[model samples]
Target: MKSKDNFEAVLFDCDGVLVDSEPLTLGTLRDMLAEHGWSMPLAECTRLFLGRMVRSQSALIEAHTGQPLTDAWMHAFYARRDAALHAHLQAMPGALAAVQAAHAATSGRIACASGADRGKVELQLHKVSLMPWFEGRIFSGHELPASKPAPDVYLAAAAHLQRAPERCLVIEDTTVGVTAGKAAGATVWALCSQGDADAQHALRECGADAVFGSMLELPGLLTPPR
Candidate 1:
């Protein structure tokens, strides 16, 4: 594998990569579904929700249940989930250190690209004290025409950073995110924070350049020359 030499910026995906909020989000969704007489297994919930935005996830649920997920349902779900997230979210292991190291190494060129809305991303980052590392550097799929599995979000993040697509590196934890990054012409490093072996293998098959179990291993991949 050839080492990357000209990567001037690092882009991150928020939910699984920066904060370990997937479990909370998935649990909240399951609980909400249960209120409507729908019960989803934890594994199935995780598979369905991983890397997908709330609106899209709701659409999927609508398709499955033959019931329209109305705006009221979405609003209520987000209100409850946001509160839970505020109370429980935490930075993923080594995530803060990795962001800091990357920022220091690149002179403040690290950015986050998330499937979450801007407010939710900001709130979680602030709660975990990781907001400062991303000052003025967060982009959301809400601002794009499409979310993960499409190149819009990553492409927007690259454009916001004023870096060429090939000059950026994307850190992602889902197959959809990896595909998006590659589609945007960025190299991807997949983190196995949410899924199992099969999922990790699928991410690589989709387009990840490498995969790691934790962000602690990222520094070596970005180690600067002496």
Candidate 2:
């Protein structure tokens, strides 16, 4: 286990952590797929695409349907989804508070390590008023060689934070993210926004240092040991 006091920076995953946008985005993707005559259940769609980038999801769709999902199709889907997301999105419970608290404690070293493209992540954060909190502290996996379940994204965030991997704490909501944090040598705290006890257990098994039901509990959960 990582020593609690070892961490000097906090890295957050954006989608399900900073904002409750997963269901909305997933729904939009499902709708887009349906328009092309490819029907997919919400749960199944989420299972396949939840921590992946839009480009990767498009590839997966192409692979599954044996039909090309062109860049134009992805661009159209993202444009529509971004508009809806901007209109309807809100922060997850305690998300802003947690970010504030972590920033105060870490002296402004809180960073976002998201699988989202840089432009879209920045826009969403800006829309929700979380942009300033992460100013100059965002790391997009799209810029890295690999995404979650790989250590690149988290490592990049840690590097940008000027903190050692073992001295970074990652706040994440998915099993793949927990795995990636651990692989990057960071202690990971899993948030149970997905409401799946099985998934929470899987996160623990995959190496989350702790799990919390909501970000409201994260301050206490992240307190350093004396």
Candidate 3:
């Protein structure tokens, strides 16, 4: 909404995009799965569940185990993983600075649209001092009828923020996140910090408008002069 900025709003995805919690999340899932008659490697878990919701994850697990995962089992998995993330989640490198830069440049028109539940988003944002930047503007994928790789969260966020989908720029760190952003008709900028040229190339194939290695590059990319 800034007179000078080009985009109407910046939509952010929380986990790898905001916090350095993807490793923690994947690690916890791997351990929890190992306890449940399967042992998923960290790599596989990241590939399957990064930027996805609990229900999608349960589907993967059920497919892997060849049996339906009970509601009780699914809830317990989330409970254990949630406890682990609550204890030690850190913001991504330059996350606070990038958030501040975005708001300063755009007149506070940034919002979060993540596959995480509301409680998890709140906790992670507060832990890293990014809460004030988003506050009431956070949109959870859990709030939608479907989560990412679907566009529901991003579309809902743009609606809530009073912006058109095309006028919002989405920041994400996974293919699922990128797909969701693009599906919502927003330009997606993927942060593929964990990958090399080949990996970043794959991200581009997933529909990232641009790809960068760190959060330090985020604010500049989101607010290029018109």
Candidate 4:
């Protein structure tokens, strides 16, 4: 009884969409960058790194600090970030309900595709008790040839789900993630948890097919096939 509104699979992004880990992640990164002489406000740090891998910003970091981005520095960042998230991370509001609805609607065909390191993604999901829903289906862009703003991770998740990208629904929170989902040919829906009109507009302009505030709205939006 599949209908136009139903998708064969539902793919989700990890940070802002499933767990409220962005602030912690960006905050840790901001403090670390300050130690390296690249201090900036939290908002500026977020604008620079949201939906992007820290390693991917090596050139920018080098440019600002006159120092190479080293593995030791990255490990330190990961260690601090993971500790913070393990202590304070929580699932986004209604995230479990949204995930449940997607799982049921697609008969368990769902995955988490994120532009983060595997360890970070797994740790956050585990801390928030969301690991079971994704488990082996978690796809990390850091493990692929390219990350978000590229189609690699979403495409990989869709392939693992044994579904065509066109038949998948990608739920993302950032414009970078939306672009990746759209590039993968999925129907991209953005979760604008902040309820910011500018974010909604930016997501749409970045190729999101739809944008809505609150994860609670997702279950209704993903209407079951009649």
RMSD of each: 1.8, 2.0, 2.8, 2.0
- Model 4 residue 108 lDDT score: 100
101-169: candidate 2 lDDT, tens digit per residue: 888778888899998888778987997899999898899888889988799999998988889989888
The model with the greater lDDT, 2 or 3, is 2
Against the true structure, candidate 4 reaches a TM-score of 0.96
Ranking of all predicted structures according to TM-score, beginning with the best and ending with the worst: 4, 1, 2, 3
Task: Provide the overall lDDT of each model, using Cα atoms, as 2-decimal numbers.
Answer: 0.86, 0.85, 0.83, 0.92
Task: Give the least accurate 10-residue stretch of model 2, judged by summed lDDT.
Answer: 1-10
> For candidate 2, what's the RMSD?
2.0
- The CA lDDT at 226 in model 3 is 71
TM-score of each: 0.94, 0.93, 0.91, 0.96
Local accuracy of candidate 4 as per-residue lDDT tens digits, 1-226: 1235679999999999999999999999999999989899999999989999888889999999999999999999999999999889999999999999999999999999999989989998898889999989999999999999999999999999999999999999998999999999999988888888888889999998888888988888888645
Better of 1 and 2 by TM-score: 1
Q: Please identify model 3 stretches exceeding 4 Å from their true place.
A: 1-5, 223-226
Q: Cα lDDT of model 1 overall? A: 0.86
TM-score-best of 1 and 3 = 1
Rate residue 140 of model 1 by lDDT.
Answer: 89
lDDT of 1 at 35: 76
